[model samples]
Structures are given as C-alpha cells and as structure tokens.
Target chain A: MSQPSHSSVLPQTELTRHRRLREQGSFRRADLDAILDAGFVCHLGVIVEGRPLVVPTVYGRDERVLYVHGSVASRSMAGGTPVCVTVTQVDGLVLARSVFEHGVNYRSAVIHGTVRKVTDPDEKLEGLRRLTEHATPGQWSYARQPNRKELAATTLLALSLEEASVKIRTGAPDDGDGPDADLGVWAGTLPLTATWGAPEPDPLLPPDIPVPAHIARREGTRHG
Target chain B: MSQPSHSSVLPQTELTRHRRLREQGSFRRADLDAILDAGFVCHLGVIVEGRPLVVPTVYGRDERVLYVHGSVASRSMAGGTPVCVTVTQVDGLVLARSVFEHGVNYRSAVIHGTVRKVTDPDEKLEGLRRLTEHATPGQWSYARQPNRKELAATTLLALSLEEASVKIRTGAPDDGDGPDADLGVWAGTLPLTATWGAPEPDPLLPPDIPVPAHIARREGTRHG
Candidate 1:
C-alpha cells in the first residue's frame, strides 16, 4: 500500500492524472511494475478508421517500454497511432448490503502513448523473447526461437510506460457504516483466484513425452 | 463447437466482421450469451476528449441490451457517446514449440454501439437487478434494493448487443506438424481456471449472522 520509491515513481502528466477515486490511484513505479508483472494479457485500445477498437493481446515489458505483437495485417497493430494498453486483474467482488454501492476489488494499469513498430531485427527478436518469457517463464530458452521469415510475418509495437495510470482497490465494502448497514443482509467480498491446472498434452503427442519441469511446476500455482 | 440456434444468432454487421482469424469467429447468439453470463466484468472502450479510453466496469445483460453503471461523476459513463464494450475470458495458455505459434485459448465478445442513458424508471430498476444478480446469483432478492436518492446518483447506460463479434479458441496449438515439432520440446496447454473462495465477512459483522445460502453455494465453484 506504500507509495513506490521516489526515483522509480512515474511522473504525473495530464493523461496519467487520476480524475476519479483519487485515493485508489498510485504513482509509484514499483506499483506499476507489480501490476504489469502479475499479468501477461492486455487489451490494446486504438483508433482504427475513426473508430475505437479494443483487442486482447499478449504483452511484455523491458524497463519503461511495453511491447505488444499481432499479425502484420491487424489494423490495430499498425504503428504511428496513439494507443491505450490496459492490464487488469480482478482480485475479488465486493458485495454490499445495497446494490448501489457494489464494486470490484481490482488492480489495473492503463498506459497511454503512441506506438512504433520495431523494425530493427535485434530489437524485434528481443521483444518477442520478452513476450514469450513473460507469459511462460523459461519458455524462451526451451522453445525454438522465431526465424527471420516468421519474425517478418509478425508486427511488434512498443509503447513507453511513462504516461501510465495505476489503480488498486482492496478491503471491504464502502457501505459498512452507511444507512443500509442495518438491513441485516450478509455482505462481504468473494475472492476470485485463478490457478494453473495440470497441463493437457496434445492428443497427437507421443505418449512417452512427459511434461517439462518448468510447465509442470506451475500446476496448481496461482496466476496473476 | 456447433453454432447456436438460428433464432438466437446475432446479425453480422460491417463493424462485427471477422477480418482476421475467420476460423475462430462465430455469429451464434448463444455464444455471446455464454460469454456474458460467465463473467460480469467488462472493459468499456470509448473516445473521451479525442483520446480512446478503456475502463473496467461491472455489467449486466438483459436480452439484447447490456447495462453498465457508474457514479454520475464518472467521465466515462456519460451518455450519447459511441462505445465498444469487450468481455474476454481466458481459458488457458497455448504453449507452442515456437514463439510464432504461441497463443491463448479464450472466448471473447466485442460490442460496438452508441450508449443511451436509461430514463425509464421501470427499466432502470430492472437493469440494476440484472446487474446485481449477474455478479452474485440470488443477491438481488437477498439484499435491500437501491433507494430513490441512490438511484438518482447512479448513471445507467444501455448498449444494444446487435453489433457484436464473437471469437472462441480452444484445444491444442497449431504447430504440431510444423518444423518446430521435431525439437523434442514440450508443447501443450496449461488450463487456467478461476474459482470463488470462501467469503470473508466484514470485520464489524456480528458472528451470529451466518453466510447466506446463495453466497455459500458459490464457494469452490468455477468462475468465468
């Protein structure tokens, strides 16, 4: 709950300002990193042909840059346009005594900036590595790296994490002391948690091929 | 999976066209219902002051309309704005032998339309009920409903489900027969499942009050 250290804190800009629920907003760099590291999937929001399109995609972060990839033909992945990348993790559902006060306990980070395609071969390959490893740790070294032709078919865009907004909500409902507290209704939070279940091998795989240790260790472990 | 019944299929529009990955797209109305019923949270995408913003909020669906509410002071909740609401449920992580083939198993729906404020009192009340029960089943009748002042302070906007795009991805990775299959590396899916843990009562609650039956029943149950 403490603010991130000053040196690592993100600078507050016009776009990063918390207009609502200011108490739940955090400007700490550590807080931003924690939220980003906790989840690999993010919704990329961009203006496509004068319309707002939000597409879910996998992402990775290296320092202050966030990388997202999609098919080269994807209109949303085209570079030079401003984008909003959002990563949200719902921790629990807040059930109050009255429907008016209901809310969710979640941690969300939204990054607003212009994205540029990574054309340099080295950075593109490195960006792809970070993305793969971000979703599945140890998979980068374990799997066959993408070849030149494959990389050419993919579009990688990088956005700066400088202008980002982070919001985290926790604890009980806000109506505990309100007028509805006397309603005699049971009210609290129902925590939501996701875990990695056992790996389901491909039906065509050889029966003797056992699951790798890195993948096997994640079974029953919490995700995000 | 087979398509939903003909009577319930969503009509495809220019906006809902499956421009990419046509194989994973569906026009089945039942597919949209299943995706919405499984989760109550959605990301609201809209153009605010010329910039696209994506906000996470709770939602409820009644037939052909989706209802989302926020405080009247919320900038993102204003009416008369064109919006795109997206709901995504991540089922699993597809681990492939090559980074190029890595993907996720998920079901997602993207809704595009202009939002209108709910002015009718009856429909507003019904919409609130759907929102409450959608998050916690049976809670609408269990708890005290919203009062006059509470309802006045809330902004309820309705968006038609007519223009929606559905995409579902399941099963194994597509690189089984590709060049990377001979690398002897592990390739499969790590299923991700979320469940509701035991409800944690408020600290100030009296110990004599037992958890409601409807709430207790959700414990250890799968969440979308």
Candidate 2:
C-alpha cells in the first residue's frame, strides 16, 4: 500500500483511523513526531510464518522514516514485511473510584508500513547513524563507526511515518463527574517518571577515561 | 496450537524457539514469571484483516493465564484470535566502543496463544481484579468494583503463560574482548530507572480526601 500524504496533519487511512475512543486520537503529524522522539525503544509487530511476533528494539527516526536495526536473522527485521511499530510512554496511572473507569496516562504512537530493508551503503550508514544518535546523542561521533562487515551483519529496516496514529492521555481520572464520585474512595493519579541514572563504567575500562559530557548530562534527566 | 508442557522450563515449541542470539534466551518458567511480574503494561499484537497491529494495554496474570482488558470493540480485543502478548522492561542502554555493538539491557517475555474471551461473569470479575491489583496493589479493594453494565462493555482476553519465551540482557556490552575495545572510547551502561512520583490529586477530588497509604507507599519506589 502506498501512503502519499503531503498535508501537515497526518492523513487518515483505514489503518491509522481511530475506530473507538476518537477523542484520544490525533491527526497532527507533530504529535506523532513528539511521541517517536520521546523514546528510543519501540515494540515492532510483524507477521512471521502466519503468526504475529512482537519484539522490543531500539529505533531512530528521520523526517519521514523510522529506522530500526537488529540481527539479520531476527523475525522482526525481515525486509518487505508489513510492520506495526508502536512507541508508548506510560506517564502515570489514573486511579479512578471504579476499576472500570481507571486508565493509564500515556503517550503512544503506532505507525504502519511495509518495512524496506536499507541496502544502499550510504543510506545504510545514514540510517545506522540516526539509530545511534537517536538513543545516545553525540555517541555516534565518539564511538567507532560500523565497518563493512559489521554493517553487513546488521539489518536496518525503514518504515515510513506517513501513516501513523498518536494518542496522549493526561490528567485526572474519567470518573470524577460520574456517580462513582460519591463512593468516597480516594482517587487520583500516581504519575510514573522514567529517569536516567548515573553511568556505570564498564569493568574493563581503563581508569583514566572519564564519562563524556554528553553522556554525563543525561544523568537524572527525564527519559520519556 | 496445544501447549502442554509440565516441566519447569518452558517447552521449545516452534513459536517459542529462539533463532538467533541463542545465548540470551531463557527456558526457565520462573524467568518468564519474573519478567511478567516486573511490568503491568504489554504490547499486544494481533492481525487485523491481514496486517499486524500492536497496542499497548494494561495486563495482569496468575499462575497459568495472563489477563488483559480493553473495550469490546478494539481490533486487538477480538475473541479467539491468535495473538502475541509481549512485555518488556528496559533496564539501560549498553553503550559499547563501536556503534555496531550497542545494545539494550532488558527483560522481555513473549507469549503466543489464541485468546479466550471471558464469557463467565465470575471469571471476568476475577480477571479484572487481578488487572487492577497488578498495576496498583490493593487497588481493587480500595476502588469501587465493576458493575454489570461496565463489565459488559469491557472485553477480557486470557492467554496461557505456558507458551512463552524469556530473554534477559544484563551487565556490560559484549565488545570488551573485541578489537573495538582498543579504540579508547569510553563504554558502559547508562541505567534507566522508572519510579513513581508524588500522586497528583484529581482537580475534582474533595479536599478532605487523603491519599491512600498504598498509593503513597509507591512514591519514590522503583517500578519495573
């Protein structure tokens, strides 16, 4: 299937449209970009041998494509497969009076496309570069670049960001105004925060080397 | 597919078998239990029409079955569909000297089974209770229980935990003994920690209501 949307807002397709909970859906392309940027790891779902397989893998994205790499033999890394890449940032739990009304405060984006195996040497380099920089910025230049053999063993799959769905749920529980409010059960949100901790130096590292500024700055920072 | 394994280790079914990175795979059933217990949210993958769809949803599990609830109308909530439920907890980013060796320290469990819809009301209530308690302990007792109407609108799917593949990656990168270690670029792990923050009371909550002790206890505690 071809996705050819040029509008600023993501064009709705049968795959990207929200059939239920329409209010939680977003048509804005920027919202999709933000959700993708907030997390480096994503759950990639693909059909393997007539069965659905979901794997967690680190990813990087450019203006229009999401790049993920894995070992060449992995099921999710197969080229030309229709893949659903989902990135979710769970912000908190909405503790409502009723268990039925409870919800999770989160930002999630699902992108659907036929993954194209990156083959061009220059494009593959760029994709791998984006993948490294996406997870740990400035480390691309600091780390040794992938040599030809390393690149060959790695499979980088690129999926277009053209067809995507973005959903962000924030704030209080949905049962605040409902009849359950009279139950007097304590209800609110317990926010969840992901933070980067201090860098643990590799045991084999020589003592003379210090944590780089870029890596050091990430400590204690919000991850998603 | 019939999964009738009685051993402490998960049976190596065609679906659960690991093709690559054989060293990272774990066959122990207890390992799968630990991975599932570490996280409440899971990425549920199912084939809709013909393409793959991955959704992030809250989940709970018991000794034999894993439970997840969603709106009855969701594509991922369909009954008797072959599904892949994957739960992953990212511990840290493994930064190595070469970009090619970069990896994620994570614990993940992937289960494949045909989902069974809860038609019995008693099992439905128990499943919902387990789900609520999974995300927030003591929540089911503190919150208002689900009524008939709410239960009808919800769909609970049960997948057997018997067929699962567990993989846990910990410690430093694998390139320490490789040639890239001579590059002199600092390499180690930047740990990721998920913690519960101070509860944000709902704006509509009565001022006299205090935060529940169970909820308060989670604050400043490690999650996943």
Give the winner by lDDT: 2
Q: Would candidate 2 be rated incorrect, acceptable, medium or high by CAPRI criteria?
A: medium
* Candidate 1 per-residue C-alpha lDDT over A1-224 given as tens digits, one digit per residue, 9 for 90 to 100: 22343357778887888888898899988889999999988888877666777878889988878999763225655566788888999998888888877788999998998888999999999999999999999999888888999988888889988889899999888888877788788889999999999999987677788898999999999998
Model 1: residues >4 Å from true position, as ranges?
A1-6, A71-73, A76-78, B1-7, B71-78
Tens digits of lDDT, candidate 2, A48-164: 877788888989988888998764225454567788899999999999999988999999999999988888988899999999999999999999999999888888888998899
TM-score for each predicted model, relative to the true structure: 0.95, 0.96
Question: lDDT by residue for model 2 over B1-224, one digit each (tens)?
Answer: 22455567798998888888788999998888888888989999988877889999999988899998764225455567788999999999999999988999999999999888887999999999999999999999999889999888888888888789888899998888887778788999999999999998989999899999999999999999
lDDT (0-100) at residue B136 of candidate 2?
94
Q: Give lDDT per model, in order.
A: 0.84, 0.88
The alpha-carbon lDDT assigned to residue A155 of candidate 2 equals: 86
Off by over 4 Å in 2: A1-6, A71-79, B1-6, B71-78
Which 10 residues in a row give candidate 2 chain A its minimum summed lDDT?
A70-79
Q: Where is the poorest 10-residue window by lDDT in model 2 chain B? A: B70-79
Candidate 2's error at A208, in angstroms? 0.7
Model 2: lDDT equals: 0.88
Fill in the DockQ of model 2.
0.79
